[model samples]
Target chain A: MTPPTDPFTAFAPALAGPPRLEPTDVSYVLEDTSLGRMLLAVRDDGRVLTTAFAPDAAHEQHWLERVAQRVSPRVLRHPRPTDAVRRALEDFLAGRARQVAVEPDLALLSDFQRLVLTGLAASVGYGRRTTYAALAQHLGRPRAARAVGTALAGNPLCVTLPCHRVLPAAGGVGGYAGGPAAKEALLALEARSAG
Target chain B: MSLPPFQQLVDDHWRDVARLAHGLAGPVHGDDVAQQAWTQALAAYPRLTHARNLRSWLLTITHRCAMDHHRTRGRTTAHEDPASLAQAPVEPPPQAPDDVLWQRVRALPERQRQAVVLRFVGDLDHRAVAAALATSPGMSRRLVSDALATLRLELTDPEDPR
Candidate 1:
């Protein structure tokens, strides 16, 4: 048996199973807004992580899996953690406020997408619309208008980041994850509030 | 009315559930039993509508997990070698000083033990205990009374003939 010794058996006891991952508690609340049913998710520290529109059963499942993979598997349905953002959204949708006072946790977004979105938010004020080309220019990427549009199309923060305010340079309402009707409605609401 | 956040439920009743687990599942398997209950609770949380008596509901889940732990232990004891089983990790030091008292409670009949744990360790009233045990309020009261009598006799007379 000394001649048939295997090295791996000696370490088998130490190599039992995968290490346990700690649970990160992410809280969320779903509410009906002027646009449609909106699902807002926040980190344990109360920073807004996602603001998706009309999340159907499939969309809800996909969102859960995404958060579980990117964050932790302990995503919980909690209203208090998301209450402040929900109130701000309610006020903005009701035309009582021009903008939601939400600090977005863009940890889930790519660096380039974060750069483009933050640049657009900083340059464009409430009730203001900007062309994708203009936002790219503002970000110092003058020729990246198409790239900027693609980033905005995949915007995870949605209303909280004011992605609705960005439109096509050629004069159409442009594509919105919330749908074309939602984009037009949001623009109209912002126009009324700004006026 | 909308149910309160699942996190809130976990926060408020975690200690109670852990205590009940220790009482029901015993020290060795208590932590595992509590964790299992919370895992089950999280999966079924979204469909919960009412917020009334959430503690009782949680205790019910914990009881179910404790039951499952015992059932699994029963089957494993037959196949598992005694020497290897002795090498299993020891549970953390118990918070309660009365180890013997808890052992006696665990020795009680199943229903009586559950009733006592839910009533004392869980800090739930008789009705809540009833809800957790899926019995009537009257039966829960009788079970607790009977368990207390047995514990009292055993504690006073160390040589109780059973």
Candidate 2:
């Protein structure tokens, strides 16, 4: 074989010589729900990272940057969703736990956001609903409805925070960070749970 | 709010990390060393306080992993010889240009070879190379220059100056 012109280019084969890192710290599991395909990432200790609506793998790839920024960059995929996480997600999605509140790990959240999240977690139940204005007022920041929206949008733990239960004050269901479709599904699911 | 580019970390650094491992432990244990380094690094990636160069951080991990492998082997499963690495199962064949080049890299003197590999293969800067090799930046630069000069004579790159 002729010696390569450039050493760096020539030595590229060694790139394949070593085993790669496969992180198992965080695991991803995809489930097809009534709304669409939902991709959920979880931690070893059963912390629900995010439940995004991913109609397909391409759709899921859109969240790579956000997922890394919000949850972790080293997340790994489990062969299947863990039983505990699956059960919790099923209960939440099915609206069986609507009257109850949820508390997911909020390590990535800010103090002010945590305060707002804690308030929402305490006040809103699965079957109940609140408006962003009401939530801001509840936190004594009546003029901060937009800020409340920003906080909810950045909520590290989505469904667990029940951000879906919050809506626009004027009457229509509000925007959900997961997607508008997911919000509609959750609201519809809750309406049934309420009855 | 500005976090490091986490998603691209492995995809960008894996090859460089592997090259460092192979350089340190030779072909046989190279894969193992790289694996351990990634596992360890990925486990601690979340709380990473800061790093000027992510590659250096990865090399630091790879270097430690190689050391651990050597420590565990104690003298039994010693690192492979450069001449013998041609028989490594991972690559195409010894006749392949890339394989030939790597074998030559393995033949370089210890410190010079490490400096060269860390500089080019691991894509580390002078300071990072020095940090990984536990030497001064000046020493790392000198070693790389000397090694590259030798490689130039042997491999004969027209683009590179002697």
Candidate 3:
């Protein structure tokens, strides 16, 4: 009797019958943007042999191995974004104007800052605009728009909460975490969809 | 205290996750339940430091998600025929060798069957089972015991205690 040819034949073992695992030919790219480092791993067939994370080779290699063990070493075709960012991107692409879940990885913020970010996350909707002052008012401190802007300027997950959707009441594109070009692109994308 | 490595935790406790899923939702939907549970757990990983028991915490989340899925499905399935419920054949009871005993076990109320499966299949202690079912431990224990007694009576032969 011949065995299955693929090595990833044990991917999902808990299912009723034996599930055949097909080796996916894909490349996974991990970006540690805050640290200005990126790791790219190309899995030929099912085996991951070539892995690289620039700027800090040793630390990147260690982090790659650690992350690999928790998730499948075989990366999905595209770069993985934070869950919140991914959800926001999907909603934007699908022509929906809402985000269901916020990304949990908003590092470098105080607890109060996070609460403000959460309010901002909930405030911005698809195809609509809210001012920073409007957001501060919603948080029960109308005087805190500048503080709210500071919190949003440091937002780690860019598109998920549609932070780019916030603008000045005088009708200016407010500061964007991803910079003005990215914000312009996002707004244009949303505008094209709405049109 | 520094926590154990995430991979090590997942490797050590993945079986418990599967069993909990199976108990909450039978085999057909268990894998989806487990997958969604893992996703939710990973999303909640940043707050894991506050959790006392990782295993129980994971199980609680999985159980809640499974129950939510079941309720959503029940609402969606309300209009379906009750007779179609028997689409899936029941696996023969492991200890109940007699057909009569199997029939009696099948006839037990859904809550009693769920409590029994949580006890046996999930290997969850009585208290954990009660927590999973959102009921009192005494009630959970009574449900299982009463279920077993009913099976025993239906399957008993007058000739032997064995």
Candidate 4:
């Protein structure tokens, strides 16, 4: 295809008129997490649509297309995937053992929550496990394990933050916002890849 | 108050959300922005007892959501190559009659292209376009004028009177 000298012209038709809104039977879920509230609209075909935050209460046409994107199938198929969760999945699936270097998309998160999520992202590793108690201790708050768990449960970016990897030191699976089944499935996937 | 009213709102504004989003980023990002707007609007519906215009409300939410997405993406160290902007798919290719004019419009600056889309394609008046872009009416007018001038220069020669 010959590149247009003016890139905007190629899409001018779509731009010329107000864009049309099409209706689809997609089921959407709203999740309020430690980071921020997110909208997860799922099409029947499993395309996942998510935004960083809620719109302001006053504005008409509050939603804009610039914020939306279709997540790749690999990320969407994972049992627990947030915008942050998907990045970890991408790295691990691409054969990276330690995704500590991966960063969470914190657009919706407050600074403290972003810091907690970042710490969780670094502390948790693939196929390995850490207890919420251990995590609290790691962050220098031995008594705040429950708070740490609450933070983990409220994490908007699920797998990317590796909340699933944080198990109970006593051998029970911990709570996951995407549900414990999702947590188990991710652990299994990591194990399979490891072996 | 009931589910159907909420459902009706979704049906009415879904595309507008997507379109506004597309203008902000492109189609791929538009879908995500629309989805987020729907979820946020629905959750806050109970608090909105006096909402006179649902469409505008939804569009506002969509724009905010898109901005949040931009802000979050900005914080990450990742950089998008300028070349990638060229790779975004064009939805409707122009037919022979308007193809040349369409090409000229596309060659305009990003701000001008956005102004044209808001005014012409979005069917938004100057005020609505201004609201969507968060610009003043005068500025919006200037954007449209600049875009039109560029298009006229490219599409029509001074010597030619069609």
Question: In candidate 1, what are the lDDT values of residues A1-195, reduced to their tens digit?
Answer: 111112111211111112122234788777878787777888888788888774585666556556655665457666778889999888888888877888888876789989988887788989999998888888899999998888888787888888999988888898988789999999998888788
Q: How accurate locally is residue B39 in candidate 1, as Cα lDDT from 0 to 100? A: 79
Give lDDT tens digits, candidate 4, residues A1-195. 223233333333343222222323333344553333444434435333332234242211122121121221111112233334344344654556555233334543456556566777776666777887888888877898877777766554555566778888778686665556656776877788777
Candidate closer to the true structure by lDDT (higher is better), 2 or 4: 2
Model 1 clashing residue pairs (backbone): none
What's the TM-score of every candidate structure? 0.53, 0.71, 0.40, 0.37
Tens digit of per-residue lDDT, candidate 3, span B1-162: 334334444566777777667555654456667778866765565455554577877777787888788787772221133443344334311222322332353466778876765665556678987998899999999998887776666555657655
- lDDT score of residue B130 within candidate 2: 94
- If candidate 4 were superposed on the true structure by all CA atoms, what would the RMSD be? 16.7
Each model's TM-score for chain A is 0.83, 0.74, 0.51, 0.52
Tens-digit lDDT track of model 2 for B1-162: 434434467666778887778767766667778888887887788778765567789898898788778678662222244444456666633344565566666677868977887787677889988998899999999999998777667776567634
Specify the highest-DockQ model's number: 2
Candidate 3 lDDT for residue B83: 40
Q: What's model 3's overall lDDT?
A: 0.56
| lDDT tens per residue, model 2, A1-195 | 254336564554345633443435566767776666766676666666666567765656655556666666666556354556667767766666653232366666788888888899888876788999999999999999999989888765667677888888898877765578778887888788788
**Which sequence of candidate numbers ranks them by DockQ, best first?**
2, 4, 1, 3
Please report the candidate that would top TM-score against the real structure.
2
How do the candidates rank by lDDT, highest first? 1, 2, 3, 4
Q: Looking at candidate 4, what is the lDDT of residue A172?
A: 67
- The clash count for each model shown is 0, 2, 0, 36
Ten consecutive residues with minimal summed lDDT in candidate 4 chain B? Answer: B75-84
DockQ of each: 0.04, 0.31, 0.02, 0.06
